[model samples]
Target: MYVQSENPVEITEAILKMDIRPKDLIVLLVAESDNLNLQALIDRLNEAGVSFIGGIFPGVIHNSTLHKVGVVVKKLQSVSAPVIIQGLNTSDYRWPDFTPTLSGLEKKVTAWIMIDGLMPNIASFLSGLYDRLGDRVNFIGGGAGSLTLEQKPCLLTPNGLLQDAAVIALLDYDTHLGVKHGWKRLAGPIVATRTSHNIIYELNWEEAFTVYKNYVEKDCDCKMSPANFFEISKCYPFGISKSNAEEVVRDPISVNSDGGLVCVGEVPENTVLNIMKGIPENLIAAAAEAVEETLNQSAHNDYVRHTMVVDCVSRALFLEDRHEEELEQISRRIKAVRPEVSPQGMLSLGEISSYGEGYLEFFNKTIVIGSLY
Candidate 1:
């Protein structure tokens, strides 16, 4: 359920009033624009002895609408208590072992991962997580942070709101995953010569910003400044090449002082990239395609318990008013399968999923759909 009241007291009251089971875990996907005192809300929940794990995102999705000021509270059953991991911004850290936690569970499990979107070592952390868990457990989630691009206490937990941290929980529900980004390649295979975590210092042995600026300026017939970088770069994102698959997009959120490009996720050194562009119609179509892929992945999926969408916030920014069309497409397709389930999720900073049972990845300007059964 989604709550529109920004008042911390009212929100807590709504949560407490819910007919939640003793073991049911609550998820709070709050909108960044609400400007609520998250600590106060957390304090209220703690006082009431309620357990929850979630974050503040750029926006929340309820049904087919994108709400910039509200809370999307999800009650998850057959799920384990959340495990919090810190030091995501640093390079060296150990992923917690979940073997003991899952030993007693008889059914197959899926992991819901929520990380600090602005953390630099997101790819590294995810890689470590996948290595530890492997494909034994399906993974689906997205990065959470504000659109302001400022790192702060955004992620909520039993302790309080924290930064540079991650919350993970294991769910017993079976999930069908579909990942897609309708961005077509407009410019070619530029190599990132130098990169550190999420910062690209060089492309083809030159300044990353300089190379990016040249292509975008010539194509769009306009100059780019730090002031207008986000406004213009939203239309053009860099895509990392993946063999025989859609290019994994990386959103360049800002330009750094050293002429580097800071992306939402990491860009490894020497990785080939492409400048990608998308039309509103194509993006909307891709949303439907994601639903089709998820529904088609399993033949016996006659009943869907719930549908969760982790769509890119940047896609909404680019599509503008037409973003509703994208959501509507997702809604229309899901309704065809199970009319009872409505798509509910957040407009994330980065989307996460195991690509076609391949491997876990963090993506930007992409949509990840998970149908729970």
Candidate 2:
């Protein structure tokens, strides 16, 4: 259910009294930054007699705006479905070692992880964790935002909510196999002729600066500056690749002081990439397209189970004041079609999707577009 209320405890209480089976595995996504009385929320959960795993998000979702918080609850159908699992936000999740966290949970499939934006080496960490989910599971969702206050102290997790750590959660359900996500390069299909880790050395052999500058010039004529670059391409919104062959941020084209372009994650030397754009209209269409594709993989969907959108905050920033409009549009389009994509979602800092055909990317599927075709 899409809940935009500030009182999560009251919301939970309402849900529990609704004849929600006792065995239901409650997943409470408090997508707000309010200093949730952690102890109080936990007390309520314990009282509910339901197994739950969720955290506090930075942004709250009241009317609109992607940078908001809210709660989303999904009840298990038959058995205590273990389709989703959320692990502790502790130091055990280091680099490649996160592979084993899914050792026994691989069978559960989809993983919805939420971390703090300030978490060190998060994108790389997610890439490593994805490598371990085998090929059938998809890893989506990055850092969930919080109020500036929490940002100073990073919201704590079930174990503890603070910065400097990450949380890994898994979803296991037979009905869950219904979702899918894919990506195809948009703008350039521009092959990275030269590059580094997260830095584009050159594009088509032209100084990365010249190539991107020319491209931006063609679209918008403005005095270029460090801050101007972000305004130009709307924070380098990127395209997706399908073959799953590319690494790093495939479509991002950020501008450097010297006039070169800086991609988000990384781009190996000579890897083909695409400069992409998801204009508000395009984003709406993509939202629709994402649903269309998900239907391709799974059919006879009983109800549009709540969706957990792991959208890139850069996209959110790109939307600026219209970010709320964008989320509303997405929610409207999805609900218009599926009516179950959950009007509620989180504005993630960054997102990681599978390249090849190993894991079934989740966050990339429901709320994402063109990336998972």
Candidate 3:
């Protein structure tokens, strides 16, 4: 069952009212960036014996409405174990080192991952997780951070809150995942000539911003400036190509004085990239298509209990007034598949999923729909 309320005390009371004891629960909280009482809320849930995993988001979805200040809870019907790992820095993190810790769990496990959105090692982290778990473990989750862009202890695990770290909940259940980013390549597969970490210094042997500005100005017919970069860049993102898979997007956060571009995730040197753009209608349609695909892949005999939608906040910002329409599109499709289940989601900083066919990747300007049974 799903429950939400703006008042912390009221939300806790509602969870306690549920007569059926849940083996686990997932919590999504949308609070002010400067709110310092987060620890108290976690302590309250811990004292109540609710095993949960989630984090702070700019906005959360409950039923069909998007809320900016509230707590959304999903009571898990099956047992789950949350593994919290810390000490994740740009230089010193490996998935193989953590693989041994996940051993001895059930054969059919679904892993739900939540990571710091600002962490520069996200690409390496996803690659390492896929290398260790292979295709045996199904997973879907997103980056957790506030609108302020400052890193903090946003991820909540059973132990406590975490920052610059990741939390994984290994569940013994079945799940179906569908991923889509409604972005089309606007320009060539240009090579990233010089890059370090998440900063791109040059593209195609030219200044990164120079090339970016030329293409964007030509495509959108608008002049580019540092002041208006974000406002205009939201409609245009960088797409990194992969073999036989949909392109992964990276949102450029800002431009450096050296004319380099700083992105949310790493843009490795020699990586081929394409300038991408999306229309609001196309993005909404892609979300609906994702829901349809997920339903089609699901086992017909098994009943779906809950659906989790993790979409990039960049898309939400792009949609603006039509943001709720995107959610409505998802709801309409999900209801057509299974009217009994309601979809709950959040505007994530980034999205994570692999559909159980390939290596997991951290994506931006994308939508990930997951069905948990």
- Which candidate tops lDDT? 1
Over 121-179, each residue of candidate 1 has an lDDT whose tens digit, in order, gives 89988998888778777788999988889988889998888889999988768789999
* TM-score, cand. 1: 0.96
lDDT, each prediction? 0.89, 0.49, 0.78
Q: What is the lDDT of residue 156 in candidate 3?
A: 76
Provide the global lDDT of candidate 3 against the true structure.
0.78
Ranking by TM-score: 1, 3, 2
Which lDDT value does model 2 have at 338?
66
> Best by TM-score, which number?
1
Those runs of model 3 whose alpha carbons end farther than 4 Å from true positions after fitting are 1-6, 19-22, 29-36, 77-80, 93-107
Give the range where candidate 3 is weakest over 10 consecutive residues by summed lDDT.
27-36
Q: Write the per-residue lDDT of candidate 2 for residues 1-373, one digit (tens) a residue.
A: 5565566487667667656664555555566554446556666666765565554654534223453445655553322233222232344543434344455553545555555554434445556566665564655555554433234334334444445555554545422222222233345766667765556768788777667666656655566555656566653444445463332343343555655556444456776666544455554455555545544455444444545455555555555666565566556654565653454445544454443234533231124421111
* Candidate 2 deviant stretches above 4 angstroms: 1-70, 73-108, 117-123, 136-138, 146-156, 175-211, 235-264, 316-343, 352-357, 360-366, 369-373
How many backbone clashes are present in model 2? 45
Regions more than 4 Å wrong, model 1: none
Candidate 3, residues 15-129, lDDT tens digits: the string is 6776535555555545433243566667776788876677888887765777776666766653445767677774565443445545655565677788888887788877777
List TM-score per model, in order: 0.96, 0.66, 0.91
